[model samples]
Target: MMRSGPTPDAGDLPFELPRTTPRERARASALARALASAYPDAHCELAYSSPHELLVATILSAQATDVGVNKATPALFARFPTPAAYARATPGEIEPYIKSIGLYRNKAKAIHAAMKDIVERFDGRVPGTMHDLLTLRGVARKTANVVLGNAFGVHVGFVVDTHVQRLATRFGLVAPGASITMIERRLMALFPREEWCILSHRLIWHGRRACKARGAGCADHPVCREFGSACELRISAPSRATGGAPARAKPAALKRSAPRRS
Candidate 1:
């Protein structure tokens, strides 16, 4: 199901938010504050030495894993180490190395265009500001967040990827169906600006390792303590103990139930 109602910005369709009460907002904020202290070591996993590399790495990371992207980027960077280099290369040349990533064609196009723009406008350097990066192809809020926080040490906004979005809803920090922008806005109202970058990274790590969509480990999780009333464990205990039948059928009991009518 989607989030409850229209957001503060109600111009869009499908209504991107649930109507959060003031009290609920306070509780969510408090929980976020506590979680910040709980997970302080959060950071982006992608490896990159320069701003341009981080930009390209984040773009390639779409629909792909950091480990896989990392494997491909070393050779990719060796060949096209800067925006100028990438801007000059043909898509055919880049595609062979990046073909393993999903949506390689689209990613290649985005990378080529973004590099060309960077070289032409920024003098072969990736821009640090959000507005500037947004102009680059394939640089959505998520990718911009990764580069801003990780590359420039600028925590302009929270990174609300699949993990962040899923865990936020499950933790009651957000309602359902909130857009990434809406979720980030709500979270930003609560978390300190200094911790936004690390918080996103930690949340992503936790979501990947513990709070997975399929089989979350919520029962004994340290973060489970502040889960409030709504957070539910993805795993459940055996049903037999809860006013249900025993696991095994006894042979003697089964035999006694048979009738021996002549």
Candidate 2:
């Protein structure tokens, strides 16, 4: 069943998110300003000229770096330039191009199946809406958020990648241990609806460069000084902010799954 009519700025938000207090919104606003100032030009790093290319790149990006996905994608894109092109090929043909990426075999299947479905159902165009996009084989809420925000200019939800999740907890934008679904809704409630797209990019930018998951890269920055509580969380409760590092950081809560036709 497609999500009909108005879609909330929280990915149809499968879970109920707690409402934000005015104080929480004020703090979140300040953090948003700090991020925007720091990363004024933040944007999706996955290089693509079209929506379908972006979709495939984001799929391959699971457990793979954007750089790695970019490297593999040039040849792949040149070969299968459109949904029709990929739809014509078997998953085996798609495999060779993306073989260097993690889980190539499975990704090949996802890409092939998704593209084939697009051709058969969506008139070979990448469907821009969340419900339609989620029906594609490889897409989940996060991947859909990337495609929706960056490709289609539809910011229906916040993206919660590892960097975003870690930084959110560290910055106190979210408490430790919120599920990804809940975190997306919480961020949505805190930020202005129009800011959702750039907001995620900015968070990712700062997450990569400054307020890293392990520890602060440079604690002197004002945002970190005010919001950088992960260090304290680690000191007091090892499992909270740090995910008890020295051991492995907990694997991200999201996984690529067949979408719920709910």
Candidate 3:
């Protein structure tokens, strides 16, 4: 994958053991401003109807695309409709639907165990609080954030996936070698709590669509002005710009009726 340069006003990682300068903070702020403006319509792409669905979908999303997870979830949900059903399902049965996703065997075990825990401990309900959600097997901060934001509508923090991590680093949002928790902490300081969830979703969308992992489409990218990387803007020819139609009339052809040049 091709790595983009640091965002405008950004420098080396901040918040190292010794601490960092104001430049990192300014960079984070600038990039956040650009991203917030550029992606006003950002949202979670994973398809789900309920908290339990979100939980299972997020777990299945490990190293897998949201589209892939959506494909497998309908069948998985149909087979194991509830926590009790999932708890009772054998790993062998669950594996087949999600087998195409990354870490299928392990995810099968975790989801099975997690559903069982929800039933036995939480009374067959997905817990809303961070404290209760973390108790499930294979549930990490990333998964917990998904449940909190999508299922409960609680925006506790930003969920740092690979896209978020890479973008944050490029934007100088966090110091190098900083843990996810550290990144979340720094981001919390930069962005309002309300924007956290949407910000992540939008950035991920932008990263996937325009600023792709390999080659980026920097042409007229809204955030380009705020990026530290140097990129050229590519403008299509005027003929191509007119909706693939020819110009109204060629200047040379129009001037043909006029007097010839000396």
Q: Write the per-residue lDDT of candidate 3 for residues 90-199, one digit (tens) a residue.
A: 87788998987888999999899999999999999999988789988878878999899878988666788877765554444543345677667556556556667888
Per-residue CA lDDT of candidate 2, range 17-117, in tens?
45555555666788889878888899999999999999999889987878889899999999999999999999999999999998999999999999998
My TM-score estimates for the predictions, one after another, are 0.75, 0.82, 0.75
**The 10-residue segment with the lowest total lDDT in model 2:** 253-262
Question: How would you encode candidate 1's per-residue C-alpha lDDT over 130-237 as one tens digit per residue?
Answer: 889999876897888889998899877778887787666666555445567767865664455676788788778777766665533444676754552123522222
Q: Is candidate 2 or candidate 3 better by lDDT?
A: 2
Query: What is the Å distance of residue 66 in model 1 from its true position?
Result: 0.9
TM-score, candidate number 2: 0.82
Clashing pairs in 2: none
> lDDT (CA) for every model shown?
0.68, 0.74, 0.67
lDDT of 1 at 107: 89
Clashing pairs in model 1, backbone N/Cα/C closer than 3 A: none
- lDDT, candidate 2, equals 0.74
Most accurate candidate by TM-score? 2
Pick by TM-score: 1 or 2, better one: 2
Relative to the true structure, candidate 3 reaches a TM of 0.75
